[model samples]
Target chain A: MRNSFKKVYLLISVLMVVMLAACSEDETNATSEKSGGPVSAKIGVISYMTGPGAAYGEAITNGFNLALDEINEKGDVKIELIIEDSAGKQDQALTVAQKLMSSDDIVALLGPTLSTEMNVVGPEADINGIPIMGTSTTAAGIPQIGEYVFRNSIPESLAIPAALEKAVNKYGAKKVAILYGNDDLFTQSGFDTMKAEAENMGLEILTIETFQKGQSDYNAQLTKIKDLQPDLILASALYNEGAVIMDQARKMGIDLPFVGGNGFNSPQVIEIAGEASEGLIVATPWFGEKDDPKVQDFVKKYETEYGHKPDQFAAQAYDALYIMAEGLKNAGVADRDALRDALAEIKDLDGILGKFSFDEDGDVIMEPTVLIIKDGAFQQFE
Target chain B: MLGDIINPYHLQIISFILINIILGISIYITLSSGQLSLGNAGFMGIGAYTSALLTINFDLPIFLGIILGAVVAGVFGILIGIPALRLSGVYLAIATLGFGEVIRVIFVNWESITQGSIGLSGIPHLGRELFKTFKLTGFDPDMLGLKNNQFIYLLVVLILLLVNILLVWFFIRQNKSRVGRAFAAIKMDEKAAESMGINITYYKVLSFTQGAILAGFAGALYAHVMAYISPADFAYHRAIDILIFSIFGGSELIWGAIFGATFMTILPEALRFISDYRYMIYGVILIAMMAFRPQGIIDVSLLKWFKKKLKLKRGGSLGIGTKKYN
Candidate 1:
């Protein structure tokens, strides 16, 4: 029965291969015939819609959809948004980008939230001549790929130095210790930038430590930093690791204050770390509760729909789509080249996050703001 | 039926199914021999990186690079397999896992060669040439140009199907020969088989090498199709997923790998419709399937019913009754 089962299984395998080949040949025959007039231009947005990093992805989507909805309502030009889930995998990102680029209707692409995915899809974008503007890829070398690729979010190089400068000048902390996540590109890049800036500013670098992403224990690294007895601990990590380390640091009776990059912006970090997150300092381009009129409108609409405030990711993505929409309208040509030119020409556009313009390499030029967590409330530094 | 067959999305899906078919068949060799290996992902990584580097850096012909990639992966498999021949089952699985992890770490840390975690870019499109006809054929390149996605999908499906057919024929021929008896005896009891004068290590190493060759072939195809790859693409999680799929699809069957790959690839897409609840739903579904049908969905137990259903649809009740009896 087992041998028969194995033979039958092999037969089925043979059948499946035949069936798939037939399916492909059929598609090839179909591809030989085609033509269509452009209707409403559809823009395919590929992002990590669901995964370990789903929350951040969801935020980017929320911001993007908000912009799309507003633009469509105005009816200046008909634009449709088609979304594909990257699932935070490199292969999926490239596949989704290729599918989008192949379609004539899709004028632009909006995401692939992480820098790792950017590496996969960037080549496709450059080759296919599709404009792909990212929401939150802060990798140092992303913009150098091509003219078609643009990012509305400020790079970590710009954001980290401002945060470090704040820690040195405002908090008057001379001795600083650093703990960062090595696996994540954003965290690693932020840590490298902060380290370089700290050395340049003449701050005493007491200790440098690293941990992997999705880690729950940081007792060893935190204890090592505590022994250094630095005035401030700068942690560069996502919410999961940052929360665990902060909670453990408090339990270990380390009273030293903590400062972090954008990874600390999640409210879930507070919910997870509890009292440990109090007096935690972080920096980001967008704050959900900021009183700025543009930010206020975005926060109000987002809360009304999702029953929560927008995070920096959501704000950046929302701003990204709006920027792309504005570029599309300005370019007036729905094809790739015109959109690329229009995006490159963007200057002083006030977004929910900040007033931004693409630099020569298609990176957003914006100042980073520092925020303080006091009694579980995020407050912009005075 | 026509619409379903001709849809580019479905073609892409089938291409992946074919790739999975190749990997699954290769894995069947090891599974039938009662040896578990987790290092197939390593072979795949080597194949992908090798083919990608050849096509991008060396400007070699795509077909030649793909074959070379498989050869390179096969060589690495043999190299790794010889040292790992002493291990079995769980120990073998652990060794293979360690091997895969070491390769991934090296690919990430060795920036000078691999471009680090940033990954190599500007990989030339291999599939595009499949649609392009030479001037002798009187084909215009502009009008005949295939979208990279379509070309890759078709290319992958064609190559994988051809390789799979060849493998099936080879295995079938081997089954009737002395080699087949040797492999079966070794599978039954390695020590007993060894006492009977069969070289246990040779067959074991052969299984690992063959499996690695398929994995490498699949990886090479994937690199060209996607035009980019990173260390994370071949992470331990992916290795585990492939193994889980193999078991879930019934490792004993050559087609189970395809079943598992197709299931996993489309399963996530189907789960995507459920949005946030997809992962939770996936775990529950996997548990339920395993509990009810551990032999897999395509086992003999279901084959009888499936064949009957096919006959019923083809010629109605009259033919279906006769088919069922047969």
Candidate 2:
């Protein structure tokens, strides 16, 4: 048995050596075949398509796929999308990013949903000189990763101040309570911005609380917040926890209007929190109720296709694909560096997200519309 | 085929398989001595973070960082093993699971160094730095008539591959030693081994420390290859994966761990075509594997059965022996 095992091992080692040589030759042939006319720029997306964060993934896929179909039909500059599910884990996201890089020949990458996954996947794509754009990664320090990384999603550092200012003025609230998820980069950055902006406006912070992502019970945190009796609540959390916190807070009769970070832009908060979602406010680049012809067309088309209205995730993803399409058209070739430079040079373009453009640091520069949940859908705060 | 092998993405996967093999063996070392730990991932984290920090902060050589990381993990193994060794079976598992969580919590809170849950990226990768520091001018043998320039990257991968293969072979052959027997004796009957003056405590701790060192080394390589390390990477689930690599591969032999690590590492990526439902399929396969082969995918009994079958076929074909082996 031992001898047979040794023989088998030797056989495998020999086979491996032969294959390695064969593989190197195979690569030469492949490179030589790439001298043809430009093909579609293959863009890969890493997303939280499963696990607890699947809602974002579902919306992103719907939005992008709808956009992809329209863009491919237009035939200006052809594009193909391949999305891999990260399941909200950093390791899985890294593996998927590598897998896409190795096998698919993706010209660019889009997202892995959360900032944590982007934190892992961004540098990898950048290191390999792959143009990676983020649709929803809003944490601080992402643009600082490398030259190849870009994000269309507004970072919390910019969004939270606009949100706090709007909510305070509209509600005439004096004292505020801040609640956030401490473990995640998105929420932590949002909380930091919220605190600074709140103090900047001279609003007294009555209390501050935090919870980890995927934690079901926010009762303890809400109980403490209730005790503080702040006139208004400020929260930075993903839709999953944000809804539950609002639900439980309303149940506890703390009934003050809540101002939130980017995570609350999803309509799933309305679905989950139900009646309690009323008076919840969030600043967003993409508004489903926008009166613009482009925005209305998307909202109507997305509703017909998906049987529901587009949320922030859907709208941003829709815009993301369009942005990439424009970049592909300008570059006129499906190469990484050309697409990256083209994308960087984008000054302004009309989309669902308004005049979308990449700033010098590759972060999005756009004004946000502060909207409050009224009746059911989000409405412009008066 | 050769082209696919040279793809940086495929090379990365190959590296992960190699790293996971060491991790599988890490768990195997403890299990062979009737010891159970669900904390190999924590040890791996220790090695990764320690090595990563040393390299990032002090600009130490990668090799030195790896060695220091392994040492720290080994010391931790002894410290943890001494107290935790008193418990047996499930209790030991629970205790070690707690150890993994504690390590993760520490990593999450140690924001200054670890950079907290967001982790640190652009971590001076091994391939880039190693190639820069060491020129393989003479070493780049255009082994199969490939271009020397193209083969440089392959040469680095080949070196790492050869080293890992040797390590796997060493573990496979190491079971014949006296220490291996001591482990076997302790597992079979602890009291009997103690009666024979084996100093069971020493042997148990030795196995634990060995497992930790191996995991730590793998972690150091993992840190460099992934170029990113986060607290979430070493959570309780990852420890479960290390244990699964041993159990699913056949914990009975060292070969089992290697097979388990290789197969399991490849399985998820192999199922990548399934897209959204791949993880569900992965889970289903695990369930099916456990149901059909409870002893694992590789074991001594299965090998012996194969050998007997081979012998019968050979004898029958040659018409040399008419032995009626049922």
Candidate 3:
């Protein structure tokens, strides 16, 4: 029985190796082929196509493809895109980044969705001298990873302070409680900014609590916060946990106004929390409700393509693709260095997210919009 | 010739595989002694954080930092092993898993030291300063001027080769020594081994400590290679991955651990063409492998077949043969 099992195992191993080699070869061939016109450039698109962040990945890819299709149709620049899925893993992101960098033909790279994954791949891209633009990575020190790394997404540092000032002024919140996921770098950084801003605003912090990422139960922390009876609650959490925390906080009868960080900007928070999400205010760079033509066109196209309204993540990604195309057009992708130089020189570029520009550190400098969830929709907070 | 096959991309992947192989062997050591440890990643975290801090803060050389990290991890292993190895089966796995969580939490909450959730970045890569110093002294270090990734690749490969040789020698010596018999005796039948006057606790703790030291060493190398690490890198998922590598490769044999680590590490990258569905396919393959061959991808029969093909001595003892030591 063992001998037969060994034979089967060996056969399986050999079969897998052959399959892998064949598949990689096929991929290389597919990527190399260009239709009709000369392929002026090749760009790599990476995102979390699978795992918990699949929604964000899908939106980014959809936005990117929309832009790519438009550019290709116009025949101004024939840029071939090779998309790779990170599967929401750092190691996988590293592997994909390495693969993209070594291909020699890829002039620039984009996406990887999360900040943590970018932290893994950003340095490599910098070292290899390939410019990588992140669409949704908002954590601090990301652009500081190296010269080649850039992000269109505004960090929490810029967004949270504006939102906090609006919340404190509008609600007259005297005492506030802060809660955040301790494990995630994004949420933690959001919390740090919120705490600093709260102190700056002179809002008395009644209590500070933290929960692990992906943990559903926040009742224990909520119960403690309820007893503290803070006039307002500040939370730094992703959409899923933000929804749960809001729903549970309301259920626990802590009906104070909730001010959230950048993570709460997603419409899914409202969908998950239902009525509880009402009166919840958040600061974001992209507000889909904007009546601007460019914003409306992108949003309409995205809604038509994906059958869902484009959230902030999708909007930023849409702008990011346009920014990359503009860089490619200006630089005329003869070499990676020229493209890198072009990307660095991008300034005052108008897109869905207003006039987008990169600072010295490759971070986006943009005005943040404060919005409150009212009757299951985002409204400009007055 | 080897350089043609290994581009910078392949080099990074291969280096990670080497690190995982070291982790696999670490877990395999405990598995051989009939212990299932799910806390090796904790030791890895300790080693990574220690060495990274040492190099960044104390200006210690990378080699010395790695050694210190390994030593610290070995000491921590003994600390956890004493009480942790007392449990058996699923309970031991759970305990070790809890230990890993605790360590991760410490790394996260101990903000002043670990830099909180932001993680330590800009860790000096191996030989960056050495190459710079050589240039300053007017010595053309062109031959030694490997990029960080390339240098790390070579360093990890050398360490892997050295570790493999040491492990092989140790295993061979262990097989011939009385201590090895005690470990085997305990694994087969604890009550019988106890009656035969074998000190089970001492051997178990010793093996667990050794495994931790190996994991720590791997972690130090990983930190230097990647030039960045966070508590997230050493979370429970990593511990589980190490376990999977050991089990899938067949933990009974040393080569099984090495093969499993290499194959599994490369499998995801190989399945990259499938994109989002790749992980699903990977899950199916794992489930199928476990269902079909619970003993793992490598077994005694396969090893014997290789030996036969090579026309090696048939009478000599093999590290993973079915033949009982006694």
Clashes by residue pair, model 1: A59-A314, A63-A318
For residues B1-326, what per-residue lDDT tens digits would candidate 3 score against the true structure?
A: 44344456666677678788889989988888889999999999999999999999999988899999999999999999999888999999999999999999999999998987888887766534454555679865235665444554555566656766786678658756887677677789888988888889999998899889989998987888777888989999999999999899897787788888988888878887667788898899899989977888887777776656444343344534434321
- Sorted by lDDT (best first), the order is 3, 2, 1
How do the predictions measure up, each by TM-score? 0.82, 0.88, 0.92
Instruction: After superposing candidate 3 on the true structure, give the runs of residues whose Cα lies further than 4 Å from its correct spot.
Output: A1-6, A19-39, B1-5, B127-165, B172-176, B312-326
Two-way TM-score contest, 1 vs 2, winner? 2
How accurate locally is residue B91 in candidate 2, as Cα lDDT from 0 to 100?
A: 99
Each model's C-alpha lDDT? 0.75, 0.81, 0.83
DockQ, in order, for the candidates? 0.17, 0.31, 0.52
For lDDT, the strongest prediction is: 3
Q: List the per-model TM-score of the A chain.
A: 0.89, 0.85, 0.92
Q: On residues A307-368, what C-alpha lDDT tens digit does candidate 2 reach at each position?
A: 98787888889999999999988887778899899999997888888998888889989988
Q: Which stretches of candidate 2 lie over 4 Å from their true place?
A: A1-40, A102-106, A171-175, A199-206, B1-5, B135-156, B306-326
Write candidate 2's Cα lDDT for B147-208 as tens digits.
33224346446756886787777766666788889999999999999999999999999999
Name the 10 consecutive residues with the lowest summed lDDT in model 3 chain B: B317-326
lDDT of 2: 0.81
Superposed Cα deviation of residue A53, candidate 3 (Å): 2.1
**Which pairs clash in the backbone of model 3?**
none
